[model samples]
Target: MEKKRSFPKFLSITLIILVVVGAFIGWKAYQTFIGPSVTDKEEFFYVHTNDTYDLVLARLKSQGIVKHPDLFDFAAKKMDYPNSVKAGRYKLIPGMSNRRLIGNLRGGYQEAVKFRFANVRLKESFAALLGNSFEADSTKFNDILNNEAVAEQYGFTTDNFFSMFVPNTYDIYWNTSPDKIVARFHNEYKKFWTDERKQKAQAVNLTPIEVSTLASIVKGEALHVDEMPKIAGLYLNRLRKGMLLQADPTVIFANNDFTIRRVLNRHLTIDNPYNTYRYKGLPPGPIMMPSIASIDAVLNPTDHDYIYMCAEADFSGYHAFAVTVAEHQVNARKFQKALDERNIKK
Candidate 1:
């Protein structure tokens, strides 16, 4: 046939060509999948949009979420995502591809943090909550609470900043600014006091601010929701009769330290406007943040003739209502006896 065909030469040339093509394809595929595919070991990641690329890269490296930050940067740039990046706190998970991550970042998806304000003391507790979300200056927040101009602009008297903040669960972005957080509380408070509430405030011959202050008192005194209306009635009766409300919570609030576990006669003498025992009427302002239930109680008090109340000796989270000071003294004595027996002086 053909002069003893050089079979080895033909075979060698064919093998060389096949090897080159295979290597080229393998390299291309590696480049495409290596950065995007989820590795077997990765679990979760936290991405911060506010961070610089270098900072993000550093965080990713520290968290072991990525092997190379440069890879992410290059991919994001290629996909035109760097310019469209949105700021937020994100949670990254396993099996997320580069394309998906880019989409999440660009769409501004964020994880929400739920903050609850139920049963909170106004000054100290609210400050702590604000600090959790922002690097808030507690002094500044307190100053604003006491600022006459700021209070007036927000339809509150400078003396009653606590009344303007109602307690509720708020869903906030992780990095929300302190001012914005405070503004949201103010807005929620405003929403709760609709036109109907305004009429009720006028009907009671109380300003919205006054109503809130009374609600704060109710919130502090009533241990249970069922007792709210009765407590509200007692205070309203006192207001109508021009008697001292003489609420113990007011004395506690006036102390400001919040550490006075017991409202002794000595504690009542502390010179502060919030001491209803010393002052004849409502304090200069609200003592604590009121719940909507408390607000409603103040707006719609029970029609009872009760003018006094004392915690039951049972400490059952219910109050003993009375129409006379003598009756209240009997209840008080019973409660004090219980406190003595249980060593619960506070």
Candidate 2:
């Protein structure tokens, strides 16, 4: 027996209910489409220079970093990020919002794989590192390393393939080309050698290549960084006195296989031109990749008269320097005893 509601009140209540239901549905839809849908976190996406906007958008959508490809296209057009995006490898994470993901792509937040070449002995290792980044032809790289014509064109001597490379960590894009990378390394090497370094080389009567060759030897022999200058002085003094360099690393370099636990008496008899035990001057090329510290040490050696050196029995990153043959023999005997105790033989 209740009275009927007014028309205005009835209409108001109906509209309010419809509005609430519609708002709820719209919210649910937005929530469902807001973030990435994928669950696998390890998979990554790579973008290249040749990728178009449509292609990038599709890749982002497939990777689950973006909720919709249309949203990326709209944002890319609005924000002008399409032209700004750089090519590289990017890790796509789930639940990443569209705006932030596009920002990452635009700003080029791609992970750079650090390539290090410390203590690398052969040219093949360099080729391998470059190959990983560029998918470069290893055969071509090896040919470049061995090609006398190319070496001469690059101002490198064909005999010393290892000398041309300096040891350092370089940040390289995953898609870097091997030819470009080799050129960059050569450029870095040139930048490190200033006019002052050239003058120092001239003062020591060493050509640029010879200086680097000596530096490579210093790098290999010096167990510690601080011992480089002293080692350089010992070798330089020997060279001045016209004595045999007799460097062990040179023999290893000539042999090409550096697996000898101890350089044997017979090993010294292998007559390659790089064998400093038989040759009077520096080897035709660098034996290993030289560190910058080692290069500087060769340019500015300590003013000592040391003509011979033997590793310290303690292996404390120091060498026992000797000015005469008797002292050298004593130091050598001490080193030999230490080696024997450690089960290392020569």
Query: Candidate 1, residues 1-346: lDDT per residue as tens digits?
Result: 5686556987899999999989987765454434454343544344443656566556656666644455566666777765675666665666566656666666767666677776667666667666655444566666666677877877777677777777777787756665676688789887978999999888877888898889889989888988897898889999989999999889888887677655788887888888899789788877777788988888888889998888877878899989887988999899888888887665
Q: lDDT (CA) for every model shown?
A: 0.75, 0.78
Clash totals in order: 0, 0
Q: How much does candidate 2 score in TM-score? A: 0.77
lDDT of 1 at 204: 77
Q: Which candidate is the best by TM-score?
A: 1
Query: What is the TM-score (0 to 1) of candidate 1?
Result: 0.82
Instruction: Return the TM-score for each candidate structure.
Output: 0.82, 0.77
Extract clashing residue pairs from model 1.
Answer: none
- The most accurate candidate by lDDT is 2
